[model samples]
Target: METVFLKKGEDRRLRIGHLWVFSNEIDTKRSPLGSFAPGQSVLVADCGGRPLGTGYVNPASLIAVRMVSRKADEVLDASLLHRRLSDALALRERMFRTPFYRLCHGEGDFLPGLVADRHGDHVVCQITTAGMDAHTDELLSVLDSLLHPSSILLDNNVASRDLEGLERFQRVASGDVPEEISVEENGMSYAVPLKNGQKTGWFYDQRVNRAALTPFVQAQQGCSVLDAFCYAGGFGALAAKNGAGKVTFMDASAHALSYAKRNAEQFGTETELLQGDALTLLADLRREGRTFDIVCLDPPAFIKRKKDAKQGLEAYQRVNEIGLDLVRPGGMLMTCSCSHHLEADALRGLVTRAAGKRRRHARLLFQGFQGPDHPIHPAMPETAYLKTFLFHLPE
Candidate 1:
């Protein structure tokens, strides 16, 4: 195997099990990166000639190397893919009673830059790395041999692909997938549009968090609920089904609000879907003097990059303040941040700052991470990103 040498003391991240090797850390003079192909597997070693691991190198990308294996004899091939995929499946089966869950969560499952979401008989896969992109055929065959879902759709429109010099496209990979499919989440049925929906048609990561709201919903019957940044009414629908007197969903996407309405209707629950920006909607609701007994603020990633951290924290604080203001005294506020860059403590601080700005005291009730299906990788902290906090506002 070809070898790529890094400068002395530059293999610290790889020694600690982090998979990525940045371009700046490599010794270009000894092992010029331009000679390596995009997805060619190469032995990674330190300057003193000690083998670190075998990883795929991408000369065109800033992430110079993505480690595939630490063992000396291991090779990146179909057999390795099959073994890793099978191991990922075994872990999920042990944790979940149902097949409807995330099958592979990129780095979390040890298969970097790959995601697979299972929807009963169908599986949606997204490949975002050149290494994984080169092995699409092998991956499809492995998925066919293992889970054997009725169909597999490749949702490869993620923006991360651009960084790896990949084109964006979505198509049926294996079998014919229907436009609409039904899956059971937390014992509730939701009909999702796979071809025309967001992130494999469902947000399975928040399944556990949505289920946690049942108790709060049941206790606050006849109470008005507001689900801001609601996607397909997951939280609002649950609240309505659990007996919220009125559920109002606010989302910027008309398409998302449409799905939310369909979900609410399918579940025989009534929800008012408002199509508008979450921040603007909150301001409008506050001006209208409309208060809710329960408010859920589940926004998308406010901080996509490290540079946006400060602005994103302020955004979180502002939206959370709006959410707290709209909540009736003694109501519940369920806030969430999907930004992996933002730590739980940072989010908690933002919530506290928002509460202080509103001159309200909030008692922490519960906090949660991503669902079990999306397991956290011990070596990579980025795998465990989602954070949800439930607070009780004083009357």
Candidate 2:
């Protein structure tokens, strides 16, 4: 195998268990990135020619190489994929009773650039990196061999794929993909649009966070809730199931709202669907003198890239402030951010700032994170995204 050597001291992070190797870190004079194919496997080494590990190199991407194994001889083949998939499945099975969870969480599962969400008999997978994309057939085979799911859909319509110099497209790698599927979570069944839904058809990362809001909803029987950015109404369904009298579901996609409505109906809860931009709808709701006992602002990642942090923070603050204003005095607000670049403390600070702007006093109630299915690699802080903060507004 070709050996990609890093410059002096550049292997420190890798030595500490980090999995990424950037293009600039490579000792190009010895092993030019251009010499290797996008998904070519190679042995990574230090400046002194000490082998570090095995990984796939992507010359066009910022994350040039994603280490697959610490052993230099480990090949990126079906055996490796099978072992990784089996390990990931074992973890999810241990944590959850039902077969509905994230089966593989990219680097968190030691299979970087791949994410697969299991929904009962169906599995929805997304591959964002060229390295994983190259092994599509092997991944599907391993998944089928392990779980024998009814279907496996590759939802590779993510923008990050473009960065990897890969074309974005969705296809069924195995079996037949149903139009819809249900995943049980926190004693409730959520309707997921598997074929044309967002981010592998469901946000399994927020499973734990959504479940954490139950007590708050149950505290005030018949409390009104506004689930902003309610994709498929996961949060709203939970609130409705827990004796919430009224639940308002809002989202930009009509398709998402349709599913959200279906979920609310399934729960036998009264729901109002608002289809439009969240910020505009939120502002309009405030003008209409509509306030809810529980306001959930689960917006999309406002900050996707590091460069967009400033602008994204502004959007977060504005939406959070409006959400705070729409909360009834003495009610609860469940706000969340899925941006990996945004830290928990930073989110807290922004929420504090937003509260001050609205002249409201909030008592921090609960701090939430992604479900156990999405494990965090200790060396990689990037794996620890999805911050959910629940606060109580004093009367």
Output the number of the TM-score-best candidate.
2
lDDT by residue for model 1 (1-395), tens: 78899998998888988988899999999889998888888899999989998888888888888888997667668888899899989988897788899999887777777899999889999999898888999999999999888999999998989999999999899889889888788777776778888888889999889998889889977778888888778888777778887788899888788877776666456678888878988999899998989999999999998999889988888898788889999899999999999999988887788888778899998999899889887778877799999999987
Per-model root-mean-square deviation over C-alphas? 1.3, 1.0
**Which residue pairs in candidate 1 collide?**
none
Question: TM-score for each prediction?
Answer: 0.97, 0.98
Over 260-373, each residue of candidate 2 has an lDDT whose tens digit, in order, gives 888877767888999999999999998998999999999999999999999999999889888988999999899999999999999888879878877889999899988889
In candidate 2, list every pair of residues with a backbone clash: none
* Global lDDT scores for all candidate models: 0.87, 0.91
